[model samples]
Target: MTFAVNPNASLFLLPDPVTCFRSASYNQIQTFHLTADASAVILDWVTSGRRSLGEEWVFSRYYSVNEVFVDGKRIAKDAMLLDDSQIDAKPLPERALAERLRPYSCYATLFLVGPQVQAVIAELVRRYQAISVMKMKSPDKVIWSLSPITGNDYTSVIVRVAGEETEDVKGWLGEGLEPLRQCIGKDVYRQAFR
Candidate 1:
């Protein structure tokens, strides 16, 4: 899918989580083009197949790519590929893709771009900077990170989150992005989170 935002205009894209099925492959690509003054919020996320059916990470493959261009110049590009067939552990016991991502069943990525999101970016940065990571016996229920796109005016931010359950990630994201309500309006923002 592709999107184009006009100058000074804002757009919000909140899509449902993608679910991969066993023996199936899922691929998605999205591109956004925006004028210097345009603003946009994009979200891409996926679940680890049907958990109740015991099909977690049983899919053959999963691929996703998201790119953003401002004034015809590429600002950010995020891509991920997970394939069971690509696992090759010749010297050790057999390994599966699920092993690499154990303890997490949901993953999400969010992008905020343009002047309108400066406040959101700043808030996220402040919160992220205050975190102190420490070694633990078990992984956290949810983990997230925030980073700014380098080489660009500090108007863009990328957030990645992984959680043991889908609802956990959703709640975290909803709170983290609460400032967006001012730009996208309370009604629209509530729709996305609710």
Candidate 2:
């Protein structure tokens, strides 16, 4: 069965400036990224426009608990503006870093986040659609393993099972294990360490 979005949630691009789940406004989102490089002072937001199981769905079960910026505020605890003054001068202001997003599955919604690294992912998927890739699974977490060209460290592809799709927890075993293998096909990039 295909993954489905709940009726209440609505997906929006970055700069939407709306609160998540404040109204009939809750939904599934795949690959949601709100990255702020303070050095750049510019925010980079990426949403795959897919709630679940499109490009971001490598595995069948997705469950996650991580900080997600909502409403352009850097949230530390319970939407408190506790550290607003201290983080204002930083390029991407810590304000945009702390806003937390929690998906209430009792509401049947599993809000996914990622694509903080997208170009890397799109290229790998394009190159290895038919080949089997290597994967390392830890519980519901599957990480895409990529070896750096210069040496032996690996860049990871994160795979998760959102809470709403509880039925497919068992199907994620085989998952997209091949992308990891095909992506490392002797063409791995040696990223200049920052």
Candidate 3:
């Protein structure tokens, strides 16, 4: 079955904002039982505007419990993040790395804090699609095995840049950030660390 947004919970990006839910209905959600690979597609859908409206949503599995809770109910906790052995030690194939780095000379995982992040994410998706020749929507699309980071009060995004230098990539991300700050307010904090 195709994934559908839960009507019960609020819709927002993961890495939950470090604040209270904006509305009462933002609790009690439902979502698909997405595997790690399929999650990239789902996240793309969110960023791509396929699932637009809905405040409260639900997930088939609670991926993490860092700071996500609704009505005193804690979401499922991920034991893997807590356990070192849970990670696969194998290195990525050189070809795969080359392919991911191709076109985009650098990659970084971004930690963004501000309001209206979903809106900001939508813009990022559009920009990435415009600039990157790759068919996929975002860096996570190329690296589908990585799990989505879900937290309350904060959210993480992955970005790819045409330049390898850290300063250049930072500038690229910063140039577009001004528009987002307008929606989310100037208190936005962004850190793009690989």
TM-score of each: 0.93, 0.18, 0.30
Ten residues in a row with the worst lDDT in model 3?
41-50
lDDT for each residue of candidate 1 in 78-137, tens digit (9 for 90 to 100): 998888885466687777879878889999999999988888888888888899999999
Q: For candidate 1, list the clashing residue pairs, or say none.
A: none
- Candidate 2: regions farther than 4 A off: 1-64, 70-116, 132-194
Candidate 2 per-residue C-alpha lDDT over 1-194 given as tens digits, one digit per residue, 9 for 90 to 100: 11222233322221211122211222233332233321000111212113443432211222222233323432211111211123455465453212321221111111122223334444444544554655645322222222222123222232322332322322221132223223223232111000
| TM-score-based ranking | 1, 3, 2
Which is the better candidate, 2 or 3, if ranked by TM-score? 3
| Candidate 3 structure, TM-score to reference | 0.30
Clashes of each: 0, 19, 21
Model 1: residues with Cα > 4 Å off, grouped in runs = none
lDDT of 1 at 78: 98
Better of 1 and 3 by TM-score: 1
lDDT of 2 at 138: 35
Cα lDDT computed for each candidate against the true fold: 0.88, 0.25, 0.31
